[model samples]
Target: MTFKLTPKQEAQVSLISSDATHIMAYGGSRSGKTFGFVRAVLIRALAHKSRHAMLRYRFNHIKASIVLDTLPKVMELCFPGVADNCKLDKTDWYYSLPNGSEIWFGGLDDKERTEKILGQEYATLYLNECSQIPYASRNMAITRLAQKTPLRLKAYYDCNPPGMAHWTYRLFVERRDPDRRTPVANPGNFAAIMMNPKDNEANLDPKYLEELQSMSESMRRRFWLGQFADVTDTALWTLELLDQQRIVDGELPDMVRIVVAVDPSGVSGEEDKRSDEVGIVVCGLGNDGRGYILEDLSGRMSPADWGKAVVSAFDRHEADCVVAEENFGGAMVQEIIRSASADSSRKVGGQVPYRPVRASRGKIARAEPIAALFDQQKVSLVGLFPEMEDQLCAMTTAGYVGSRSPDRADAMIWGLASLFPAMTKQNAGPNGARSPVVNLGYKSMKRKRA
Candidate 1:
């Protein structure tokens, strides 16, 4: 096969071949940035006995998205039989060419693997899906781009552009140093170009473009048009605040109590595909008296599907109980839980414990207190929750301002409220004594005539 580059990819190749120290290829999803960038790295590796590293925010993500998917495609289509000459190291996650060159893949979320990759100097470093990576980790990896090879050392980055506040936007678009918030010493060293689905139409489905056009304005701007979404001035949560409290993978403290909260969006299977997403979030109360968010399983699913997801999260996390929003349809929601528990494959002794919660206040009224916990830095996210964080950042004092519904944020708030009863003291009875849910079967003698 002849190696060909689309105009967008050709632009990237020209920029990368230049003397620029950093190259950013960012834009909409399904663009050719990743393929072009990976092919360039392989070209360099095959040219000399140089070392290259391909990294993403998470090891599993990079493995699935690039190492397993894009890398193989690029090798087979463009490089052809050259892939057969390379030996893949599954243990350390890299490819060893017939020559002395090496290509390593890693996820910054994995501390152990990151240490191993950082030990080696690389002629080239490619940060894939860099929007999800923290600025601090990028700096840490940049220190290792010091291999003494014949090729000029370079670092490549690509992303489905995040908000304007992201480091990529500051460094590549604003030409400002991310940390210092000032002009970079050499502005010419940082270069970036946008590549949207429109530019890669030949490689995409016609229906895909229509799908992108059907999205909300904000969603279309970021994913389809490849524009940097803005952080609203009235948002209660900021990206920096979430990053400050983010706990790296494999570092969660001992959990004292865990609960799964669900907010069903009235979608029951294929019957209603246009309903809002079902918000499912698992939160744990650590022994240190702080909160740790375990997972976000929110999506648009039928009752059976969301119910299964809820029960699955319950069993996987070993949560005390599953709390769901009953305001949608009290009896129907309860029945769904009962049916889901009956059908659960985990084989619970009888049924997973179910609790129904009613929403007496509006979303902002409920989120204000939860946002305060974040403001106080008492809560930490176990990993990145991009969609959940988006909803949170769109919530403000006035209303839910985002294009999509804030169901994920609502579920998170409910989980936190359940874990910290003090956060919702208003729901209690008079004199601050919260009413407890009592199991009626244990009663033999009453309170002894107190």
Candidate 2:
């Protein structure tokens, strides 16, 4: 069977065919990197009768993206009719190839599944979308690459580059100290090949190229140019700021008031349309006068589902009230929460206290004071919330630069505002005089124009 490959894909294939033990193809979206690498791994597995494994951060993600989407496409393109004989064991999540070789796929999320998958040795290993996998887990998998086979003991990794602070960037791209941003004195046998959307232009739609070009600056840099461009300078929150305020789990003080804040998505009833996530965050104001972020229950769900989540968090945290933003749905959001609470199997005595707050100002305007509280060491996170922190770190005065809505941050703001009214309300004289300048010494507030 004759099949054409893009230049970038050919380069990736050549890398896989080379003597390199550790290889990475990192780049932009729809760059054919994943397809090329999958094809290369399949070819290797077919040529050499040995066990191979493909892994991702989540098992469902591996099944949805690779097993269901990419793997079949690759087999059809490279080895026509080979899938007819390929036996897929749904229970084990592996493909029994026509040849003696077997391709096993699993995720690191499930401990039992991971142990089962890694119990056997393999000739080759592929870590798909490896950027999402933590460095420690990746290191653990690297130890299992000692398969005894004539085929070269190689590992293939591919991802759209994350932040420069990511281990992938330190291990492959810079081969240096992530903190100091300096080259390593002794680097390992790793090679990183980067390819952008333009590299696979012939295989992509022209409209897609236009869309890519029009992305936000931070997104365009990472997705289009395949570069690790830092947007920390523009962001309101920094990792250092968050880290300084991070407390050990179960170290929270007595809470005077706890609130469950909800940021309802506009498309609550529209199942067909793509909607933003329902941001549900639990926060408490301790007796010590410090704000503590308790939990982040943010998710993309229907109105009924998210409503249940909000009430669940409220009961789980023993929250005093449920504070919801009414800008999008008016009273409908509160009604959803009340209905869900009333219908819940875990019946409480009475209806949970629900307070609806209207969003009159812009998101950034409301978020600025909440961020200032963090700067003043008045707020701390009870535990690490990676996804929520990611959104918080992406928020800028200009607005959130991330592709999706900053719903998590919005929930945090709502909760914080309820706990500390001064954070959201504008200061004024008793008789309507000029607003007093409250110098909180927050850099974000200081940088604002007069």
Candidate 3:
């Protein structure tokens, strides 16, 4: 394959080759940032005795995303069979080029692997998705960029902008120490460039751009427009809070109860392109006393399709029940779930445990209490859910500014609220008497590994 750089990618390459010791590429998704960065690093790795490291917050992510996918794709497309001549060190997770250059990969979360990688010196250290990586890890990794190689020592960082509060924004964009909040000594040494999806429009599908265009305002700015987020104070949830609460998929606790909450859009799956997306979120109340949001399956789907999705998610998680809003479809949602749930091959329909919830109040009104639990640090998203999280951040004390229906966030709230019944809005009794609310509290935090 003939290699060529898009205008945005060429600009990124020029930035990497600059005098700045700490270079960062950030902005929206699929702007060819990673491809350009990886290609530049691989070029530097061509120098004999050159040492480099590719790293991320988690080992699995680096391996699956960069090591197994991006690296090889770049190698074949740009470097042309350089991969064939290289030997991958499966044990340490790196590639040993025939020219005596070595590129190592490690996850900061894996202490043993991190220690091993950090023990060695490197000419280049590329921190993929630096937003998820802690400042401590970045600092420690920077110390290893001290190898006496022909190439200049440099540290490369990239991420889809998380929020202004993230270390990347503080250090690169604000030119301040991430932890101390003090001014950085040499501001020029830290350089960052924003590369949104639009900058690489020629390489992206029109439909993909349309998808980005349709994202909630916050997400559109962060991922589509490629800008740092400025979450409002009145907003019940901020990106910073969500970042702190994110746990890897392996950290979920044994679930006492799991529910799949469906917020029906009242549109068929095959309906017009402008129809609302059905919100399908799976949430669990952990035995360890934290609320876990397991998945976001929200999308535009027909009644039968969404019904199958609900049953599929229920079967996969062995959820205790299906909690869906009855405001829109009434009995239609129930019948679809029941019908799709039928195993026609066996001539029997599975009796799915269903609970229909009524929305008696506005979205933000019902979501306020659920959002409070997030502030209390009692909610753990079992991995990243960008769309759902974006919707959450769009919600304020007054109203929601995230999406058309804000269905995903609503579904998540319903699933979690069902787990903590006391937090959910209760139907008023005679004389306006409501059910007594239960205190939602936890003693301490504990880690559970899958």
Query: Distance from true position, residue 243, model 3, in Å?
Result: 6.1
The parts of candidate 2 lying over 4 Å away from their true place are 177-188, 231-354, 357-391, 395-408, 411-450
- Alpha carbon lDDT of residue 354, candidate 2? 86
lDDT of each: 0.84, 0.79, 0.82
Candidate 2 versus truth, CA RMSD in Å, comes to 13.2
Candidate 3 TM-score, C-alpha based: 0.74
Model 1 lDDT tens row, 208-261: 999887765666777799998788667788765665566653445567677899
Total clashes for model 3: 3
| Candidate 1 pairs with clashing backbones | 269-302
Candidate 3 lDDT, 1-450, residue by residue in tens:
357788888888888888999999998888888998899888898865788999988787788788888998899898886777899989877899988999999989789999999999999999988767878888899989899967899888998887787789999999999899999999989998888889988878999999888886777887798888886768888776675566753345567677899999867666556887899999988776789898999998878788888888887876767899999979988888778768432122366779899999888889999989987878888876778887888899878876477889989988888887767646444566655423234222322212
Model 3, residue 338: C-alpha shift (Å): 7.0
Off by over 4 Å in 1: 1-3, 233-322, 326-353, 358-365, 368-390, 397-399, 402-408, 415-450
- Model 2: lDDT equals 0.79
lDDT of 2 by residue, 359-443 (tens): 8888888888889998887898876566687788788988887778889889998988888875556333466554432332223
